[model samples]
Target: MTVRAGREFLAIPGPTTMPDEVLQAMHRPALDIYSREMVELTETLLAELSKLFATKGQSYIYIANGHGAWEATLSNVLSRGDKVLVLESGRFAIGWGSAATAMGADVEVLKGDWRRAIRPAEVEARLRQDKDHKIKAILAVQVDTASGVFNDIEAIGKVIKECGHPALFMVDTVASLGCMPFEMDKWGIDVAMSGSQKGLMTPPGLGFVAASDRAREVHKTANMRTPYWDWTEREGPEHYRKYAGTAPVHLLFALRQAVNMLLAEGLENAFLRHRLLAEAVRRAVAVWAEGQVLGFNVAEAHERSNTVTTVVMNGNDPVSLHRYCKEKCGVVLGVGIGDLQGQAFRIAHMGHVNAPMILGTLSVIEVALKALDIPHGKGGAEAAIEWLGESVGA
Candidate 1:
């Protein structure tokens, strides 16, 4: 008999598990979109978002997803036929490059192994080859959710500065923003974008972009901007300018609560919490990989992400295993994306997640492995518990 009946656990990389407070915050009547209270709230949220991005620059909120943020960044900073150098460490970088191409930008890619982070040396060499500084922007992601690899945006920014490249540096932190440490100004990021669903502990439908003054100057000269996605238009004194239309009332309420939670925990402490939980997950995975059929998709130890862990499976379809965990064990894991499809699965240890939640997810995965007779090493759960014992002690 199935005893796994209760609140379903979501271990997916994004649209992560939301807290009750965030949900309750959104459960109310729509506020007057132009009222004094709502106006003050909109202002406060925008200002707080700048702090979340670790920038003194302006942040624009869109009634869209990460894709909208990508388009918005491109439209406001790059004109048609402008050359952009995209560094592809995994699927998302290439996807961003494709979006640039769709906007009529000339795209050049520096490819890296999907199993490792992009190398600074490679990025520097590529920039040095651009004698005339033909590249307009360098686009990359802080973490590729697909491969569970973490790229060093700071190191890459240093490489760009050292090479004296004038190209704008754009980083996507959709999967790593609130869960990890990011400094937009210190890292020399001209523009950074993320979504609401991942580390912010809010539901999907909001896109955010934090742009530096240098990026704004580029926007003034950019010829491809639209009436809706224009940053300057969105940053006016009027409250309606924030959305270019009526605001997403409930999302704002939810985001208010979510940001409050992050600030309350302290960004550094939140990051440390994620690190501990992620380490616990890795410990469990390491024990399971002792049988050699299960291993990390990312090859390098240091390159792995603190937000999500991708497990590479041999001789088993991960999709079927994922189904078993969700349907039978009441645990929903992320299906492998892009090229890793069917061969790997991801466990997200981010956003409002704690030790009990992570331990429960791991226990269910172990159960699924045993029921499916997958050849994984033993003591996975025990290892996780022991690590948590020493790390986040009783």
Candidate 2:
């Protein structure tokens, strides 16, 4: 017998739980593709996106996901055989670099482990060594979900400047954008890309890129440019060119509502909410870690991201815990991927999540551990509640 009948909770990163208002906003009739309303919608979204990214640069919307945005950013600024420095904190940035390799850009990875954030000193040393400035661009992710590591983007940017490296500093904010503080211009990010799914509280399919003047200048001679992902083409006079084809009307509507909600909450408040919820989850995990089987994937406490927490299941298969949570308790957690596959599970507390949602997810996890006879510290869920009580106040 299972008590799994309910609106199943999704505690996975990306494609997170959607707010009722956002879903209601999408339940509308389609708009005329050529109408003034459509043009205004595109304009407003671009402006709002730039605001969200904290960049004064021009923002572009694409009919794609995070991976597509990777290509768009690459093709817009670098040429064939352009050396790209990939600072690997986890899987996503390496994946972004691999995409560059497939596109003919020479990729070099500054090797980093999954358990820790990227070291700024290593990045500076690498950049200083590139005397010829052969590296055209630097790729990094503000947060890597697979390893649950949060790279210090601001620190890396400062290092790049200190080394006088001319390579464009591009960042992937897919997992951290709305959930954390990311000052694009202030952080010296030349090009930054994110998806609508994770922190933005929208469904997948829309990718956003904000480009600084420096990146746009490089676009002029970028041989990797193609018509579909071309920044110039997207900036054409026609409204249709904004997306390169028919617009994703419903997704735009969903995004607009989601952005509006975020703006209403204020980005700072949203960040705090994510932090509190993430910490509550962490508190529970800390208690469970005493079992000797459950532990955090990220070794450093400070490096843990506010978006998702990856729990490593030592000497145990996470699949059983994952299945027990979903099938018995109606809570779906994120399964491990990349190198950590089968060794970990993730608890996501980003976007549209509140104290109860996080607390409920933790409670279900504790229940699953108990039901599955997995050894864990008692009162894991109570520990989460105590944290919320102390931190959130009455």
Candidate 3:
């Protein structure tokens, strides 16, 4: 006997809950890929992509995912043996560096732990050590979902400029783009890459990359350029070249609606909403952590990301709690991956999330703890409610 009949709440990081408006927009007949309507749609989305990324640089749409955008950025400005410095705060940047390695570029990792954000001073030190500027590019992620860490892209970019380093500063905004503030041009980001599945509130499939004029100038001599991921090929006169082949018409429809909703809400308001919801989750988790078994994965309080919260489950198996939440309460939480796997569980408050969705997830988590006999402080959900009440006002 359980009450898990309603629609299951998805609290995972990426591939977040799609809005009904976006779904409705996709429920339509296919359009001619060569027609004027299709060209207008493509042009509108391309211009909007640059706006979302906060850049004056040219943006390209790709028929791929975040991983494919990684390759596109690397192949555009880097050569066969170009040295790339990966500022590792968590799994994704290291994974991006690994992709560079596979593509025949030499990769060096500025080692960092999952418990904290990347230190800007350490990045400056590393850049200063590269006397001859062997490193062609620096890679980082605005947010890493696995560790639930948010890196300071602006600070890192500033340090790169301070050191007078010529390496291109590339960022992966896959998990933080629409949920927070990211100024690609103002922050000195030479190349930026993102996906539709996270903060953008769209389904998985489309990838985007914005390149600065400096990066584009370097692209002329890049040795790793291939026809498919080549930036030049995508900037052709034909509409088909924008996507390398046939366009993803349905996904584009969904994305356009999603972006429209984001703009309507305003980016600053969306950031505040994500911040408030994330703080509510943190409040509940703080109460639960009184049991000593449940705690935050990030050591510093400020380092905790507004998009997702990683809870460290010590001495207790997170899988049991996850099972109870799904089977009995119809709420799905994000399972930790990479280095934090088996040791943590994440609560995502990004994308199409509101106060009730976050509060419900927190309530179900509290129920799961009680049902599983896991040691946790009582009134975790009530704490979340109290926080939202005080912060959100009336």
Candidate 2 residue lDDT tens string, 1-394: 9999979999999899999999999998999999999999999999999999999999999989999999999999999999999999889999999999999999999999999999999999898889999999999999999999999999999999999999999999999999999999999999999999999999999999999999999999999999999999988899999889999999999999999999999999999999998888888999999988899999999999999999999979988899989999899999999999999999999999998899899989998999889998888889889988988865
Q: Whose lDDT is higher: candidate 1's or candidate 2's?
A: 2
Q: How many backbone clashes does candidate 2 have?
A: 0
What lDDT tens digits, residue by residue, belong to model 3 across residues 1-394?
A: 7889989999999889999999999999999999999999989998989999999999998889999999999999999999999999889999999999999999999999999999999999999999999999999999999989889889999999999999999999999989999999999999999999989999999999999999999999999999999999988898899888999999999999999999999999999999988888988999999998999999888888899999999867799988889989899999989988888899998999998899899989998898888899888899888888888865
TM-score of each: 0.98, 0.99, 0.99
Q: How many residue pairs clash in each candidate?
A: 0, 0, 0
Model 3: pairs clashing at backbone N, Cα or C within 3 Å: none
Q: Kindly list the per-residue Cα lDDT of model 1 for residues 1-394, writing each as its tens digit.
A: 5546999999998899999999999999999888999998988998999999999999989998999999989999999999999998889989999999998999999978889999999999998999999999999999999999999999999999999999999999999999999999999999999999999999999999999999999999998899899998987888898899999999999999999999999999999999999999999999999988899999888999999999989667887788888888789999888989888999999898999999999999999889888888899988998987888654
